[model samples]
Target: MLSAVLLSVLAVAGQEPPRDCARPNGHLETVACYGERREQVEADQRVILSRINARLDQLPAEGGVNPQQAKQSLEQAQSHWAAFVAADCRAGEALFGEGAAFALDSLDCEITHYQARNRQLAAFEARYGGA
Candidate 1:
């Protein structure tokens, strides 16, 4: 009986407790870190999309974009964005909880906005040379 109780106590002590994402410094750091990383990813996406758009826009209307080249650029952008999002989501889950609604929502929103910007840039490029 004593051995059983001791074993139970040890097991409980050995288990890692969940992190509280609400602690002042920790929570703030978590939020800030995610924000910074998300911003960096957004910046990179913007650079690529901007270049692609500028190129598209520069092409004469009579000699529009090569469909294959456009498709490849889009695929590359999407792959990069997907990788960034996966990494971000993993970090968020580790900092917050698996079911952290707010953190997940914020991350999704950031990605969504970035994608929208990318689309807009593509449209701009299609209209003008990628300058």
Candidate 2:
């Protein structure tokens, strides 16, 4: 009964077949899943950033915020955000220590950050768009 329930949960969470993250059998499997997820999320971040940059380029200077200023601001904000993600994730991982829960928790933490940042960026684009 437990196995069936777990399997269903995994299936709903992800198919991650290539890395078997949905039903990871070992540490390596989870590691692979985390790496792949991180890469995919980072790629998404890059795409959104490109879109934001294009939008910034289109909007004229307003309230002393120009394209160059917006780009520079984004770069600065991203640097701080990247650092925060790293520190927060690492601290959580360290507190969790090495175990069955470690990788999963770490992965969840990372995904949460990426998802939150994406949402924030989307909202910004929808709103003022740094203009």
Candidate 3:
């Protein structure tokens, strides 16, 4: 199944995810995969936010919202989003109790949240990013 695909990936024309990370060696490695995913998503989101923040600094105030106020609002939204992700993931982990799956579930939840947030940020840039 997954093992066969992982083994054959190197022989195929296209590249594939690393065998250990894709299939995972154990629960620990399985959790590590989520960590890697979270890192990638967060890194992407950071770049987007940085660009938006820079734009905010350069642009003139819009409507009643000044650049500084907009940045502060963004900061607050980001902080609230982070808190929600943490609390929700902790709740998910609680459902699984003391087991290897609990940690994996929590990490998976965080990755899902972060990925969704990344998409939202990208869409924001696409809509509002001025040249």
Task: Give the TM-score of each candidate.
Answer: 0.37, 0.71, 0.78
For model 1, state the Cα shift of residue 25 in Å.
Answer: 6.6
* Predicted candidate 1 versus true structure: per-residue lDDT over 24-130, tens digit per residue: 24543454444544566578676866576556555554565474576567668677866775665566556655443555345555656576656666565556443
What CA root-mean-square deviation does each model show from the true structure?
14.5, 8.6, 8.6
Clashes of 3: 0
Assess each prediction's global lDDT (C-alpha) against the native: 0.55, 0.73, 0.73
Clashing pairs in 3: none
lDDT per residue for candidate 3 within 1-131, as digits (tens), equals 12223224424536535747868877655655666676688788899999988888887886775889878988999999989988888788678886767766776787789889988887877776763
Backbone clash count for every predicted candidate, in the order shown: 10, 0, 0
In candidate 1, the residue pairs with backbone N, CA or C atoms under 3 Å apart (3 or more residues apart, or in different chains) clash, namely 53-125, 54-129, 54-130, 54-131, 55-130, 57-125, 57-128, 57-129, 58-128, 58-129
Which residue pairs show collisions in model 2?
none
Model 1 TM? 0.37
